[model samples]
Target: MKPRTLVIGDIHGGLKALKQVLARAEVTAQDTLIFLGDYVDGWGESAQVIQFLIELEQKQTCIFIKGNHDLWCEDWLKEHILDKTWLFHGGQSTLKSYESLNDAEHALHLNFFERMRLYYVDEQNRLFVHAGFTSMHGPAQEFHQSNFKWDRTLWEMALTMHKHITKDSKLYPKRLLLFKEIFIGHTPTLNYDVTIPMNGCNVWNVDTGAAFTGSLTIMDIDTKEFWQSDTLVSLYPNEKGRNR
Candidate 1:
């Protein structure tokens, strides 16, 4: 029997790079294509990025987790976030992707970004998250909106102080938070290789910062193989400090 596996990680709104990574994975019906999120707000083609995932959703088992960037897209559509700020941060190209749409059509475009999940996991020995968990076996509840979605302070604390637990976190406090590898995005790798803790919570980060100088990457879970696409030229540089 062919081994079943899952491929996932951050896309950061680059449709072309996403496609190339899928091609490299040689995705098959037996395999699942999962995304860790950040569906919009970087590179060109937010509409195209959403459309691509939507189409893929039809033929394969896909799970789209929401990321901070995605939340910004939803906020932008609702005008909850200022357009100039949104567009300034790699969102201009995303806006351009839907420039031709009428109001009704635009609402449809808006819907995609609005509906997304925050986390996903299973007994299959895998879990996925946009950033990282709260603390050493920190409650998954810490990832709840009240924790990171709406509270910047908590989010920053998690980011600045959190460490990938090698053994257990509150989220998996009792079960040992097991994973031969936990694949993730949100944090750009120092170079190109995925960072894994020497003892536990081995991480495979495929987000090669495709929205900037990084390559779009995806990994084959069962084979320990990875596929990457070259950097798409940055349309919005100096979005600075904030992650894509």
Candidate 2:
């Protein structure tokens, strides 16, 4: 089989959904998996999800990008401090997931989180980030690093300018011109009533809201072919996930 580059959406601790999508996509060791992060803080298996990824990289090439939720979880793992907002937004579930982990295991997961990249620029000039960056100079020159994990302005601009303005137009966003293509996942496509990956201009959003009622997604970046898992709400019926 040919080596392929696959971009995955947010897992949000839905290990079952993550597994399903990988299987559906027929992922292999020959493929390079680029995960968009948020691997924890939604469902009941936050620790398990991180554990699985740690083990996965041993056999395959994987690029992990850190998300806003993952940052919060890393803080708790390193300092054992809980943020009230994080707790309300699925941090409690993440805490419960780590109860069974020993100190050694916690240390390993913390190391994994710390190693994640905020953004990655491929040789082909494709940018993969958990969310979006604010700098017109591109992510490398971004003044606010948090924007890499939390900005929505880039995606919003893409949507607003998509089809309305051409690349040659003076009104075209300079940030959008920075890359051949941009792939992101912090903002769920389900928010716009879509359950599949969304494309606006050169930006592709793969987050299908697995943290709530949608499915997890994995896309072949070159082909734009994708696969999805069943709705996360149905997969773990008893848990509210991030729906609460």
> Considering every candidate listed, which one attains the maximal lDDT?
2
Task: Determine which window of 10 residues in candidate 2 has minimal summed lDDT.
Answer: 235-244
Q: Which ten residues in a row have the lowest lDDT in candidate 1?
A: 146-155
Candidate 2, residues 103-193: lDDT per residue as tens digits? 9999999999999999999999999999999887889899999999999999999999989999999999999999999999989998899
- Error in Å for residue 220 of model 1: 1.6
Superposition error at 130 for model 1 (Å): 0.6
Off by over 4 Å in 1: 1-3, 83-85, 135-139, 143-181, 190-200, 234-244
Off by over 4 Å in 2: none
lDDT string for model 1 (122-185, tens) is: 5666666666564345426464552322222322333333364424445433323444445566
For candidate 2, what is the lDDT? 0.94
